[model samples]
Target: MNQTVRPERRVLAQRVTLAHGGGGKAMRDLIEDVFTSVFAPPGMEDQARLMDASLLEPGAELAFTTDSFVVSPMEFPGGDIGTISVCGTVNDLAVGGARPLWLSAAFIIEEGVEITTLRQIAASMQKSALEAGVRIVTGDTKVVGKGSGDGVFVTTAGIGVIPPGRRMLAESVRPGDIALVSGVLGDHGAAILAARGDMDLTSDIRSDCQPLNHLIEAVLTAVPDIRAARDATRGGLASALNEVAYAAGVGIEITEADLPLRQEVRGICEILGLDPLYLANEGTLVLFVPPDQAVSALAAMKSVPAGRGARVIGKAVTAHPGTVIMKTVLGGARIVDMLVGEQLPRIC
Candidate 1:
């Protein structure tokens, strides 16, 4: 018996060039051979032609969000810029009770970056999209001079649908609602810091980069009256809690001991004089659930892989409305204000 060999599909260019951004054969070949090959977007058109049966349902609304990823290291432990682009955009919609359906990815490639890097990132994007049950329906690519841009920057726009009778907003959080985190905090920031190797730090920690749509769905199903939710991204959990507290006009009192933190992440923050609560997280989200439904919500979150560490970290309070306070283990309290300045820059 003889076996057939399939030729590896790849672009001829070893490194990206300005010519690849020109509207010519080089550009077409690059797009066709590298990106579209992996994404398999429906048609070769300027915009995606999209339709879904859910759109016809009465009271359903379309959700749209866009974000850009420019992490210092294009590839980091457990994730890359491409993976973050997809997960970040998907999560923006998921936290709002939207079912992600489609995404549009645009790449800004710096000349001299290896074509292999782009290929790897594109494949990662497609893999994440598949896992999130969404499609990358359209995209654009451009190359710049090496000094004009970073190795690569990715911008993603996501579209999702919110079914009828589902409305979640930060302002919906009541005084007695509980605040919960989907998983451990500060993993992404810690991972990126270690990967940069600038501070002579090392850790086995990997980025908690994952799409939270499924986890959010699970929680919503288990507790439909979730008041508010937000992903802990650039500004981390502290910022997210502050935003929710401000929007809902309630004070959020959290127990420092109850907040989940991995040992690696805590070590990194302590050594660097940083607060883990203010470090970024790509896969974690904070949500407010009614007190009566907190048990079910936590159980639902723990049921999903992305949310195994889910737990109640705090609760809404009427005192000090629009503030976040942390109860220290030493029988003391302090305000956990939003991050004052950039703690870790380019930490998607």
Candidate 2:
């Protein structure tokens, strides 16, 4: 038995069992697995062969990316696969210091997928891509026989342009640099947990999923000398910070109390035995600045819409090379280790 689940809460309770991936009625049911029933833009119905690849943009550099959607519960409190596919690509380019220009989406649809559901998802992708000031230039579609693929996995490739003199690279970070985050953390992972019906507490800690190119633009325009910027996504802040530390060969010391985690998000972490410091944030950013330029950079970031909550979370210290230390809320300190194992697997 496929154990029927509510159309709106499809992905939860109904785990992607072996049969769901099997070609046949079971596979179709999974593809049409309606979670929150996303409503996208107009006329964005169905992926069809309008086709042949003569598509080429006139001018601009490209930053390509591709990711698989295996997020346990696709329809979380704030976002879904359709939007994540777009926003995720947008942030990758944004944090890389590029102005997102366009996107190419590829879909791997399993047998038995519903036309209506696919249309809804397409609308979502179209809406997000448009809002981020990027166009969906081209893409591909493929069907997998029963049991050969998951319901519907999407891969998005993007292209963007980086203006001259606005260079950003991890190697640019040096001694006496400061670290800043755009906003609160842990919202995304917590929201996914809640949406999965994890009855730890009564709450709706929606995912903080937002494209950050505009925010990045505001900062770079004001302070083009930025060392590096990164969006703390999948592996969470811990993973992102660690990568920066190793790449820059510098130590990052952050204050635990300085972290901007929503109270409800903090509460959920407690109930679920999770740590906000290592959790994921979709809309946030990690920026490195020369010590003398921290104040002005903070001001530039705070002036932006997505960066209203921006603050100086910490600074690079010469003592702890290649490591991140977070002062404990209890007035003590502990090393924020890189994720050795999946903290909240499938939460992405």
Model number with the top TM-score: 1
Root mean square deviation (Cα) for candidate 1: 3.7
Candidate 1 CA-lDDT value: 0.93
**How does candidate 1 fare on TM-score?**
0.97
TM-score of each: 0.97, 0.81
Indicate the worst ten consecutive residues by lDDT in candidate 2.
Answer: 35-44
Clashing pairs in 2: 21-147, 22-147, 23-146, 23-147, 28-112
What is candidate 2's CA lDDT for residue 36? 15
> What would the per-residue lDDT of candidate 1 be over residues 276-305, giving only the tens digit for each residue?
999999999899999999999999999999
lDDT of 2 by residue, 199-231 (tens): 745676788888899898888877878999988
Q: After superposition, how far is residue 209 of candidate 1 from its true place, in Å?
A: 0.3
Identify the runs in model 1 with alpha carbons over 4 angstroms from their true place: 1-10
Number of backbone collisions per candidate: 0, 5
